[model samples]
Target: MRNEVIFHSEALEKEGNTLVQMGFRCDACGKTSYPVYELCPFCSSGEGSKTPLSNTGTLFSYSVTRVPVGPFKPPIIAGYIDLPEGTRVFGQIRADVKAVKTGMSLKVETGTIWTEKDGTEVIGYYYTPCGKEKGGAE
Candidate 1:
């Protein structure tokens, strides 16, 4: 059996929005990871404590997708972002595809991915544009 794909809860969405709204650090490292583990990617340390990450970062790369690859809607904005913590995560860009660039500053927002309990549809979380129009959570 395949592992169930988790989705963002309203609370997570709210938390993400709140974090961004308050400009909270949002980087997850081996040490700073909520679950905790060995190896710190930033400091290359096997031990480190959790710390807030800088929310400001430039877009490393992006793609304007016209096809519905999975549980996401068509014309999805997908790409990788380089965090100030020296971490890179693939996230969904919430800006208009036409208006996006390779080095644009982006504010990370919360998203959800979901799949039907018994159906074939899957969904989950992604990074989207967060601001006044996108519920800045302010």
Candidate 2:
């Protein structure tokens, strides 16, 4: 599952250097959600569509985990962000990892989610932090 993730290559190349916005558009109520969504929770509308999310958002909540989970790395800074579009998302802090905190500004980056298909890795879009240098993590 870890190997199947896909990233917005352009954004990955610009992390920490600039702030980029990601967006998602709701087809049901015509509401826009940050990050991304497949279905509109409002009105239970399947008409929801995805759009790039806001680049800047306020850190709403956070935690620093010292242990690793699955294929994920340890000493990780994780948090929930309140995007400009009023949606919240959990993300990995990609900075020095110590400078992250609730209320801090964060840029959103897109990446691929990895999956095993026929014993081969496949990638798909996944959200990640963009406040650190490009290729900050392996």
Candidate 3:
């Protein structure tokens, strides 16, 4: 899914169909927002630029869904991650539900989250516990 069409192109940066990162920074208030906004939500300023979001962040909160939803498998982990730029992004966490914890370090990456009705893979951002945090050498 290296060059697949991203689910949300505006917020997810891409280079020739390859997803780069997510979010944009407000040129006025310097606040960052996900899902790209035409106007800054914090300052209501129209000046903003698309930028690659930080790959690493601290897990703020999370939940595990044991029941399947839509095309998602059971035991789906999703949560909010606080980035270094102060942007809080919500996305699926790719890890064991029992290992997920608040304040754990997470790294963002693009992957095939699901498929469309026509079978087109939808590439999107997902977070995983950092190697070090997962008891592995980084």
- Candidate lDDT scores, in order, read 0.53, 0.58, 0.84
Candidate number of the best lDDT = 3
* Model 2 alpha-carbon miss at residue 70, Å: 2.6
Q: Rank the candidates by TM-score, best first.
A: 3, 2, 1
lDDT of candidate model 2 versus the reference: 0.58
Q: Write out the backbone clash pairs for model 3.
A: none
Q: TM-score each candidate.
A: 0.56, 0.57, 0.87
Model 3, runs deviating above 4 Å: 1-3, 16-18
Candidate 1 C-alpha lDDT tens digits along 24-44: 222443423312334544455
Better of 1 and 2 by lDDT: 2
Per-residue lDDT over 2-77 for candidate 3, one digit per residue giving the tens place of the 0 to 100 score: 3456776666766795667757688879999886888888898988888888889999999999999999998999
True-structure lDDT of candidate 1: 0.53
lDDT (10s digit) by residue, model 2, range 11-125: 2223374434445577657777544446665565667655656656788988878898755567767788887777786666665666665676676554433334454443323
Candidate 1: stretches off by over 4 Å? 1-37, 41-44, 114-125, 128-138
Candidate 1, residue 27: Cα displacement in angstroms equals 15
Residues forming the 10-long window of minimal summed lDDT in candidate 3: 1-10
